[model samples]
Target: MTTRRSTLKLLAAGSLPAMLAMPAARAQQPLLRQLAIVVAFPAGGATDAVARLVADGLRGKYAETVIVENRVGGGGRIGAVHVKNAPADGSVMLFGPAFPMAIFPHIYKTLPYDPLTDFVPVATTSKGAFALSVGPAVPASVRSMADFVAWTKANPDKATFGAPPGGGQHFAGALFAKQAGIPLQMVPYKGGAPSVVDVLGGHIASVVTPLPEVLQHVKDGKLRMLATTTERRSPFTPEVPTMKELGWDVVFQDWSGFLAPARTPADVVARANAAIKEAVASPKVAAALQAQGTDVDINSPADFARLHRQTWERYRDVVRSTGFKAED
Candidate 1:
């Protein structure tokens, strides 16, 4: 029938545009050629270590070449800015801790990049906690946080803690000092390694830094962990107690993840997210990060972005409450 033929032609015409647009839509999708996971700190540090692990995991998973580039400076701002200014094509990404994204914006008077707008979180690689360690300056008998606080009170002149200047560790030390009702002086170091070194050499009474940086020293008997800034005991150090258990309400944990520039196609972000989740889920990658005291935390891009926003707000409140400001 003529009417039936016309209806069929109209149906075929309605389907033709979508069928023809499929190839063009696919053509517009970005193809990843090379990938770079930028680290804000120098190589050999924990951030770099994780970045390299991710780079290895993503090497054959997405782009042809996945390399880690250290753009170290400005306490991670330099590297973050580098990634922010990069093209939003999924070729360049930042692989580092959440400090620059969540904490620094609240502390710094002027930040080069807006964490909420400049980047899209791809995946969360790991979560880690900081350790409150006492060096040779504290007596071996002083084991717990209460004992350390008593010792500091008894030795006011030697009551000083060291942490990297303008970092979460420094703020954690400040918060601990405030909550413990101790008059402790904060000695700033350039990095965790140096701070740990000072604590080992008795230059400072204690050091508040990530557990991974001081875990080996604790094992070697060079340093003693008094408490961790974690809600619960870290699996890496089950014997250690949390600050909360000691009746101090101090709890801080840092998360590291991958972030691509904003405006990158949603599919590209999803692709990167999938590759990252797969890479982090790999046994070898998880084991490598675990060996560094980092627990793998794979999450969806939406969840990661929400986490970033939540963390930023939390840090903002902390900075406001502490009246902390970074020296330019």
Candidate 2:
């Protein structure tokens, strides 16, 4: 009896090792069957373009199939809410601008999703600065922000600037007008593309929009970039000066990145981060984004989270100072 008991004990002890190894082995398998990259804006926009590029890069990187979905409306809030309520299994991710994540919380009376608690920053895929551009209605001699301000003051009737409604670009124009001590009228467009269209048609004197949307027009001589919204000159437009350099306190840059629902498993987040970093670093992806005047900025999950927090606080103050409130 004693010998039999000893053998049974040894067998049970040996089985414990196999049981421990089972979970680790299963973890090596794919975490998801499919991956969805959700774009909060309409398709064919810059954000959607970047999301598709990353999706293409991640196609064969993992066993799961990748797809991009457009979840439009509410200035990106609708899509953000959908992702925030999604399963924490890393199957769903948000590829969107900074507004829904950082700026909306302060501007809106009640936001559906809490950016600080509802999502995890996976990686920042690209960054682009805004440009204060003047269309053909403005004289070619009005080349800089200083010159633009002087011209607006001289001709208040034609001092109108266009920007997307309730976006960073709107506030940038407002702040610029306030700082320059000019009564500049800001016309709100539904999106950047339409604003650019109006500016090209000479219906609007100037516009504050994403550099990429206006860069080609500037190159084509249809629009003139007075200054960029970055602290330094953009590499794509090295000749253009920054607003700070031109004695205006306006400096803003827009970023697009990936975010998963909060509480996703650490391993899944790590895998997604790796895939995004690789995608952002791919030559084809870099070239496509650069052609759009966007610079690649891949970061670790933790670093990206830190950046999100810092940017949130900075924009909170900005929104507060503007005293701008979105209608509930």
Candidate 3:
């Protein structure tokens, strides 16, 4: 072995420095060489937006290559089944809405996979509260939730709100009406984005949808946000009160989580959870998600699993209350 003086000279020669840095470089290596984040919807939708941002955040950090693969079909069932059949490694994860786990079984008579058994919770990526926003169809005077209620009572025929069929918006609207004791009408749309189109054109009085889909219009004064369905005020629109805050029992919030195929090793699950938390907690990533009205509500595996179970049970009642019978 070289003496201390010789070691110092070797360091000065850059040989020892290079050798020492190798461990650090290796330690910094990403957990996976490739990670496929599967989104059930097509590109450019709100869910896809969340998936893309997360994939970008994971790049060079969680995995050397992170890609969002859109596996659209069967109202998210196709992608769910795809991920369920994927390898039980950390190489693939499903980044989709909580509906497939929490709501689908109630709606569909036969699902390709058992959500409870086919996947294990990885972590929650984002949460969004549904909002009731009024457009020009309602009098400009109707600004607050109370005002909207009174207006609907006054003009019973015009108390319609555009909502997608059999989704969070539809259920949130139904639950809100039941709690508020108002008989608001629902004008169905194929999707959340299209539902806002009619409300924007003043074809419908308002639209109950995820806040992100209508946030811009509300900010632009094209649509006035009356209330959100979350238990608390939304972080994106803190000034707007929630239905619960306004004395209505309407408390509904939507969240998206990542799930890996069942039997993924516990260690792999833990590491994936850590990676997602770090990736989402990054300031830039958090800001971008917030800008899209998606809160980076990172959840630990255990916490997420608990929440999933609660939602799964809660929606079973909620769906029954709505009296919606799916044909398929």
Candidate 4:
């Protein structure tokens, strides 16, 4: 009994710093007023592209400079860790995607940072859905998910699916395979662009991807859309059937959102959040997002936090059910 009490006291003592620092940390904002927005993935990707757009839109909205820095490495873990460890002054923020923010914790055994404990949600800039698209060489009549599944089974070794490794697109393919009761040979590519190349060049049967990456191909008849992963139909592509509409009961969406280091001051977070909301609400920004087939969903901090939680929970369940490994 005495030893137990002593150990408890020692543990309490060790946590003193966190307890004591809370008050001081909340007292005042840090000196650096400028905001550094970190993008985990390489330039030209969806997250990077959206971060640049938000930065550009905030030009006259805030008094301080809002600079976007691309910290590309380790499938977005590097940049996410950088933001997690950055000073919680609200000056350093990160634009996180599905990988680091939602999918990493489930797959990685020991992550350098914690998504819930290390970051505070600010706002969700945009949300988009995924689609299964077949290249021009594939039969144009392959319009339904079941039809595609049948074709894959008929030509088991011959059919190929291209997707970016460890991305939501890859997960989409995996989930589709699991649900449709078919086996697909996923061919991992460097990025979505390369994956699209393989699909368009007749190298792969189909590619699962966010609408922005393959919207043109579908419209131009270079690719055929089988189904969308959106809960409902996408506003841009109402003609495309969703997995849910087809009675599959699967819904997945890709989102780009802003997150600051945990414990950033309320005022700072509010300021950043307000700027983001304004940026997304702008006509030009809204138009740009629509152009990419992404919905301009600028949610409040609390609502965005809820969405973040839901995303993580859904993917975590997938990891657990599939016994996914963290080898990457």
Candidate 5:
């Protein structure tokens, strides 16, 4: 409303302050902000720890502020639902172990969210094996799976393997027993740590636990690792044989990855996948993951998608073969 002279006078009289308050160029802004990696388990658990490590890896790469959110309930359903409905802008993702995506669909009577349809596979951060370790209850001469089976047949009442019920390890033990044609029983423990304790104390004949759980004990000769459930030998224990090599088709893995809500743009998914793979390839992340008994399992988006689908189907078939059911 003012003349040019009046505008000039106003600009001279503190217009610099108003100019300084304006935003900078868009290029200065982070590609994404407030990025969240939603974990289905509580904090302090292995899943949450993996998520946090990845979140740390993602900082300054994926977003300016990356956070790992714990949404624990309904056996990972709450976080699944949350991620399923999150904005498809790639700002929010569900970061969790493979079971929530691969096993839950076959185990639960119904899930609030469809893992296959509701999310797009990102990249797995890491993958590790489940192992079979024996305690003193088994004869020291029982070194291989064949020897263990023979001993189990002779000591049928004492042939029990401990693992958490309804977990992949439990099913792996069941499959091993079926394959070996031995009458073996499964003892459920609250967690692998306790189960490892029982195995070490000779309270249980053997245990099906994650490979890392017994690495040190095996190294110290406190326990003996008979076989791993991985399709191949674990890098952490390359000297150990796999159950498959020992004539049992038992294969199980612990994998962690992220899945974006369905309909997220393909480019965004690719970008996220590449970024995550870079984070995984970083020396810090790789070293830490290796220390935890996980391998650098990052791959291209297409490859990861294939792996994701196959793992889901594998768990479905495994659960079906086992006749496992969830309470309605």
Candidate 6:
């Protein structure tokens, strides 16, 4: 018994040297190269703003150069494809909305790439609620959800609304139509800014879009908000009600985040995710997002991935329930 005990202790003592050397091996490797943040939307949009904020945060923590490149087109598919095909190194990251990750594939007939197979979800940085607003030409009495639904039902084809192509805004309108059991002719714009312009110009009856993009028009009375898309009213527009609270069936928001190519190194993903968490926690960045009526959500890479899968699954069901056929 004594000999066996001595032998076991000796064996245990010999393994300590190897365990100590393991950390040194990791330390010897070079730090990650400069990061390239790819934004699918055009510069000056919410996605661009969020990406720049994250990049600035990463710059504060890491010595590597961080560059944000806007690759706007095809409703994020183009930039998404660009990142998916790029080197799987930690250097290339995509900053955009959940559409590219979750909703796009279910909608389009032929997507350029497979979201699940091509990219890895890093984090869901922020989300902003959608607002139901009317142009200056509309009646102010149409402020409540009840009033808005009644008006749309009575007007029918007269209720022309504009939304970005194949986005949360479009789905918001569809859900609203489905709940109210009324038809709303939705006009498709390439982006939110154009739709905001059309609504403010009285070219459309109303516009359902992210609050940050259309808040200014609402403040200036060019547009009047009827309700928000969530179950709760936004603090930015506290007076506005919600579709669910009003007994409707629409819950939609514009959410943005980061994703890297699949098979990125664990160390690199960890480093990138750490930088992202720090960025979203920064007071300056939080304030900026809050000012735009966005809620910052900085989660670990694993949590973000879980949320990514959950959101995609939910929306996939929503898309399938809508019976929206694949567009050619």
Flag clash pairs in model 5: none
For candidate 2, give the lDDT of residue 201: 92
Which tens-of-lDDT digit does each residue in 1-328 have in candidate 3? 6689988898889799877788999756456889999988767667887888888878887788999998977767888999999999899999977777888888878889988889999999888878999998999988788888899899999999886555677788988887788879889765566677888898999898888888888889899998898888887899999889788777878678899999999988998898888888889889888898887788999999999888899888998887878657
Question: Model 4: runs farther than 4 Å from truth?
Answer: 1-34, 63-65, 326-328
Error of 6 at 312 (Å): 1.5
Q: What are the lDDT figures for the candidates, one per model?
A: 0.85, 0.84, 0.84, 0.80, 0.82, 0.79
**90-204 per-residue lDDT for model 2 (tens digits):** 8899997787788888887898999999999988988778889999888889977778888998999999989765678888888888878997888976567778888899899
lDDT per residue for candidate 1 within 150-202, as digits (tens), equals 99899999999987666788788888888888988899765676787789999
lDDT value for model 3: 0.84
Give the Å shift of residue 326 in candidate 3.
5.4
Error of 5 at 276 (Å): 1.0
Write the residue-wise lDDT of candidate 6 on 98-211 in tens digits: 876788878988988887778887777887778878986567777666777788888786787787667777788887777677778789876677787888887888887778
Quote model 3's TM-score: 0.82
lDDT of 4 at 233: 87
Evaluated against the true structure, the overall lDDT of model 5 is 0.82
Worst 10 residues of 4 by lDDT: 26-35
User: Where does model 2 exceed 4 Å of error?
Assistant: 1-28
- State which candidate, 2 or 5, has the greater TM-score: 2
For residues 268-328, what per-residue lDDT tens digits would candidate 5 score against the true structure? 8988997898888888978877877777677676777888888888888998887777745
Q: Give me the runs in candidate 1 sitting further than 4 Å from their true place.
A: 1-31, 326-328
Candidate 5 residue 164 Cα shift, in angstroms, is: 4.2
Give the better candidate number (1 or 3) by TM-score.
1
Candidate 4 CA-lDDT value: 0.80
Of candidates 6 and 3, the better by lDDT:
3
Cα displacement (angstroms), candidate 3, residue 234, comes to: 2.6
Total clashing pairs for each candidate: 0, 0, 0, 0, 0, 0
